[model samples]
Target: MSFCSWFKEEEYRNHFEPGLYVCVECEYELFSSQAKYEHHTPWPAFTKTVHKDSVSKVPEEGRPGALKVSCGKCGNGLGHEFLKDGPDGKMSRF
Candidate 1:
């Protein structure tokens, strides 16, 4: 059995799943499912943010070059953003 809850996970490889992804605590729009991509990792990955100025960042204490990102509206920590292979073969964003 599959544990994926995404509506169209059956065909959403490196493509948005056809809905919205938001912060669980704040319900603020984070990224469009269409911006989603298969990162081949446990965490859901996005190509970019759907809303502008909706995120905040702080330097991670232990990680030398990592920046932790959070929801600007509710101050909820989202995750850390670092360079990775983007869908366009370029570095991706938070």
Candidate 2:
């Protein structure tokens, strides 16, 4: 099965409050409170990562047009990243 198939649409559209988020297994800090934003999507959204190396992007083989976002350290699947227009009128990763 494809990795992207493991997740439901609702998983990506959920909302989260502003707070620190870490990897469940390694407790590696992934995102900070300031990065959280409401994209009105099923999954929690963030404006950016806590650091440049906090997350890694893997190309989805089954879904050629999609990219999977994973934890940089433990390689846990976080979600997907998309180019969305942010409040600043610039394309932002979410």
Candidate 3:
């Protein structure tokens, strides 16, 4: 079995499956599966935000380069991404 198969089990589908899922913590949509997510040394692994309009980096008025990915519905921290390959084999910024 491959490393990703271990997470393909039904039990982890809600949390690790590859697809569009909603973040219960932030209510933002988690587009990629755990399989596509990579440990980029910032957070618990990272993946693209799925929807470009779903996230954005705006001027914080005081801080520069201060960008935050928030929930589309609630505007909470859904995490950020970098230019990387996703599990789908597409070049994306996750």
Number of the predicted model whose TM-score against the real structure is largest: 1
lDDT of 1 at 11: 38
Candidate 1 lDDT over residue span 1-94, tens digit each: 0012334443334445489867779899988877777675445667777788667777778877566778878988776665444656555764
Alpha carbon lDDT of each predicted model: 0.64, 0.63, 0.44
Could you tell me how far off, in angstroms, the CA of residue 40 lies in candidate 1 after the best superposition?
A: 2.9
Give one digit per residue, the lDDT tens place, for model 3 in 1-94: 0112223333332345556656567667655564344432323333455576555543444545334455566665544333333334443453
Q: Which residue pairs does candidate 2 place in steric collision?
A: 12-42, 12-43, 13-41, 13-42, 13-43, 14-42, 14-43
Worst 10 residues of 2 by lDDT: 1-10
**What would you estimate as the lDDT of candidate 1?**
0.64
- Model 3: residues with Cα > 4 Å off, grouped in runs: 1-17, 25-28, 45-47, 60-63, 79-94
**Candidate 2 deviation (Cα RMSD):** 4.7
Worst lDDT window (10 residues) for model 1?
A: 1-10
TM-scores for all candidates: the values are 0.70, 0.68, 0.43
List, residue by residue over 1-94, the lDDT tens digit for candidate 2.
0113244664433445556888777888888767766564545656777878888886667765467778889998876664433435454563
